[model samples]
Target: MEKQGVEVVVAHHERATLRAGNMFLKIDTDQARAEIEIDAMERAPIPTPEILWRRPPVLALAALSGTALGRLGEPSTASSAAWAAVGAAVRRLHDAPLPPRPGSGIDELATELDTECEWLAANGVLSTDVITRNRRIAEAALRPWTPVFTHGDLQVAHVFIDGDEITGVLDWSEAAQGDALYDLATLTLGHPEHLGDVLTGYGTAADLDVIRAWWSLRSLRGARWLVEHGFEPNSPGCEIDILRTQALRA
Candidate 1:
């Protein structure tokens, strides 16, 4: 038998994910988050990674088949039907029973957004025009919203697909009761071209303005963290470009 080498999937201060053979190990410093992830996966109606075993800070999972729908700063090669299927899957998750823990409140998000925006401007991370325009756009997301079971960090890379079918979704640590649109926005953050395809399967007409607002809000709130985490937020089709596109459209 051949030995399977371990591959580092992702590493940062908060958590590190490693792939060894057919198993994926997620090591998180905060066990509470891991607990949440475990609970959420057990409760979620959609397909998730199989929990192989757990030991405090490290949780192992069986690998899901297929490739990620897309990645940040890159174009998606998935078919429109595949993107639509993901939207339908997300809708099912949202329409399911709510989780026990609630997500961040509007006041909390507003406070964080303000702090991050200030940091971006002070550190000259973005131009005043870009920051100001996106800030205004971000405000639309701060309004009251009904909470649902949300896959809180539904980045394009989290949802895996084989052909036009969704195989499984990964990363449930951030899952909670939250705004459904926020999940939609996060999924299409860097891939705006697929918004229509997604909405087609969502089965409800969403507020386009609010969706755009979330695009801005998420970028503004996450830019600083991404930079500090040694990730590039300014890559093509990523956060910085999203902000600049919003500004140009204004």
Candidate 2:
């Protein structure tokens, strides 16, 4: 599709559809998402498409409809291994020195968490206790850890692979500079019972435990988001139960 001298591909993978041209445009309504991507690009993150346009409500609606399909369960070993490779790559990315937070202190993550909690509550999907617990866990984890470039939504889909090698880690809309472990946690939480291969590929047994706890905390946040975004409560389509179970073990 051609529009205003731009060729729109409408490339729909698992997340936002891409509209391509001189730059790239993402149409996800999640403001935190847009900020994450733009910020990562500004900070010289790993390779990712550039965003030049946005249709937030449209994207949000599409995501919600897809989540209702009950197709969120299941795991793929190939994909899991690929995700582990992506995690290793992200670790290398974070190894590089980074600039200070652009306009806010690193502590501003608390503000972002508050905003996410408020939005989830407004949507009638998350409990205050869940949000509060997540906040406390996050603050504690980040306390001693130094901030680094992080993929705010690292998961299987965001990671592209060819056989055992990772081709690219896509989707930067959720990337930020914080505890790098937070990114890994996002991935493991999304696939808790299914992360055996990934953990093995990424670290030792001790590191695995650390990774799980980090992911558990981040997964709680993702659970609230999934519910707020219209995934049915206690339904098989939702992974909050999976996350909660993992957190309990952690």
Candidate 3:
């Protein structure tokens, strides 16, 4: 039954998401991940949308109340306090009970980075100088970190905020045990200006160098993923800009 009000929210190789009024319907290729999302949200110590129904590829959730922290490739109008709120929310999530599953291994990411960096260089999508230098910078994040309950894909669009309060965190498919700085790095990836604001709210001593390294690692791999996922990496505040910025850094 095709009625009005339902519209596409996100579409990628793994899944397609739609928004129908106050309902969010996700059709995922990985049913196991869908199950994990439902469980993770239930365990997270934050305001998450209620799961309404779940049946194989399609799962429905109630809409969280509030606007997203910000969109990708755009300037954030959200206040500094709002950013701080996100940091506080993340801190709580890190302090929560760990999920049963673990996130990507550091070795896997290191290998992926090497492969993706090679692809970029071979295809001339990005200059060799930029890719190689950033690859070197990315090495800092390869070390060990105390695993915490992390929102594996903690991007700006995933976080919802109302004034100085974090209303909810969305997209739990990638939630697992991982580095806490990686979450902060993901949230502030392209939005470098907000790093300090988030850190102020995080209220913990995090390694900025490691966070910056994660930014490089993310950008190095993101270009190809964006193309494959039908997204514009060259758009403002996206991976392309982030790479350019990384190249200019000391």
Candidate 4:
């Protein structure tokens, strides 16, 4: 446990820590936290229980290297309503006025992508060319889309529900400003049956091509990461298979 003021944050699991205060903490690298804080201050309202302590790079790597996949059944009508509420909340979040753009342009994305590809190569995962190519495809798809504050890691687990209402959204460590449709696409592709209600709740239909491409990119990224982390022979192999299937369908 670590302390910042009266807050007592506990690292119970690998990827996340609990701040015994009004907020939650994600155990990511210093660099990742910096990026997330900048993103929040610019785009979304800064979430509470912010960064209080840092873990070593080795621990951080162990914490956030893979995606969690489960055969989530369709949410009940109550859950459906909760999703809609969350969608509305996201719309308001995106609608919030943002600050001036930073001097560091989106060019940083290329660096991050290159780093991911290089890491994959170091791990003997796959040819770097594939990563490069897919990134190009993703970039091309995002070109015509307007940018907005995006919850880069939106997933079912991050959504909090209270009866038929979405009480909260969590995990902003990967949040940033990007094409709003990219966020929607990630949600839709990850949970297709809920797409209709989510879209209706958000009151905007995403461009099909953009959504497909983003979904494809997300799938490839997950697969590549799984391979890189030596998870090919492990239970996570199922995740690779599922993501591959999603990508192929796209």
Candidate 5:
């Protein structure tokens, strides 16, 4: 085998992904999470990266053959049909048999949301009015809902598409039984322009207000963690922009 140069895909304290030729090596400090990710990939109905092998803390997977649907802080070049295809794939995943592991409950999410909001305020990350209004909007997501098999973290970047078809999805560590709407909300976060296209393929009516509320909730909760992880949640078209946009709409 010819030696290929390794490229750093993503790096943080918890985990790092390295790419060499057509193989991806995911190294995680937490082996339990890696085990869960492997199980989730095996159980998921939709396309996922092919697991080449696994060795304790490092998991090797064959790279998929498509570009990511989009980045968080950049405009998506994928067509509406591509986005719609991703939505359809997500619907299939949601309709699959529930995973054995349960996701975060509403109570847990509420507590985290409150904690994050307080931190954001105390750190002077955003204006009080923005945080307050966004927090109010975020409350709509705390209601009860039927749980389904969910991706849990279906960010657009995790979805891969070639033309108008979905190739595969990545990052399965968060997969579990949870609210289906949370998956939809996560997919379209920071990319509101594709909501209608996704809903068209979802083949069901969804509460837009609740989805918006999740946008607020997720942004509020993720901002601090992102900062701690050396990521910029305040970048253009990211979490902070999403929160500020909610304020402008009010």
Candidate 6:
């Protein structure tokens, strides 16, 4: 008999996700984080994969139906309406009741920015000129914001859609009370050209400069994490590329 092939969902720094048939097994070293993700899913307004089962270091969930909004390096083939749907979904999420935790504070993020910039320079991961220039840009995002429920790692890959409707939002482990602009910034990180569509559906004016600042902030903060996790932020269509693009726009 042929065995069902196992698919690697994601293997990263802290976790490994795999799928066999309709069930996915997410194995993590941090059980508390998994519990938090489960809690967030319960409170979230939108759809998430069904929790088939759970045990320490692993949780099993059913696979979802739709394709992701887009990948980091690829152009979104989804309609503008699809992007709008994501915007609307994010708005609903922000409006939902606050999660039990708060994300990183300004001081923490500032400290992270300094440390990551130094690491990048020390390791020769990026040029000092690139690091210094983007550091200045990232400073603007350190201001206070009225916190909202945030999908802390709201990368385009985490959002799934089918025909202009968001099917599910994934990876709730990072969900926490945080700035709404951070969510917006994360969604449109690599795709600035789609910012207007997202903002249109978001139905409000925001600090464009702050959002841009988040681009640098997010990229800098993530570079180390990605490297530690056996990924490269400097690859085309990745965080370093986003930073390069941001610099070009400056």
Which candidate number would show the highest TM-score if scored against the true structure?
Answer: 1
Q: Report the CA-based lDDT of candidate 6 relative to the real structure.
A: 0.89
Clashing pairs in 3: 73-236
- For lDDT, the strongest prediction is 1
Clashes of each: 0, 3, 1, 0, 0, 0
lDDT of 6 by residue, 1-250 (tens): 8789999978977789998987889999999889889999999988888888998888998888889999887888888989988998888899999999978999999998999999999998888888888999999999999999898999999999999888898889999999999999999988888888888888888899999999999999999888888887777888998887777777
Ranking by TM-score: 1, 5, 6, 3, 4, 2
In model 1, which regions exceed 4 Å deviation?
none
Candidate 2 lDDT tens digits, 1-250: 6564544434333344543333444555566765665566556545444333445533221111011100235444565555566556766667756644432244665566567667766775546565455555555544446677666667655555666576555566655556665666666554655456555654633245546555545554555555545555355424555544543443
Please identify which of the two predictions, 3 or 5, would achieve the higher lDDT against the true structure.
5
Location of the lowest summed lDDT over 10 successive residues in candidate 2 = 61-70
Summarize candidate 4's per-residue lDDT along 1-250 as a digit string, tens digits.
8655533333333344444344444454455554564456345652322234444531211122112221233333445665676677678767766433322234554455556656656775544554455555556453544557777767555555656565545556566557677677666655666767777778776666666666645655565554544445223323334344443453
By lDDT, rank the candidates, best first. 1, 5, 3, 6, 4, 2
The residue-level lDDT of candidate 2 at 6 comes to 43
Per-model TM-score versus the true fold:
0.98, 0.59, 0.96, 0.61, 0.97, 0.96
Q: List lDDT for all candidates, in order.
A: 0.94, 0.52, 0.90, 0.52, 0.92, 0.89
Candidate 2 Cα misplacement greater than 4 A, ranges:
1-25, 28-47, 50-72, 79-81, 99-142, 193-210, 232-238, 247-250
Model 6 CA deviation exceeding 4 Å by range:
1-3
TM-score for predicted model 4 compared with the true structure: 0.61
Worst 10 residues of 6 by lDDT: 241-250
Error of 1 at 116 (Å): 0.2
Residue pairs with backbone overlap in model 1: none
lDDT of 4: 0.52
What candidate 3 gets wrong by more than 4 Å, as runs, is 1-4
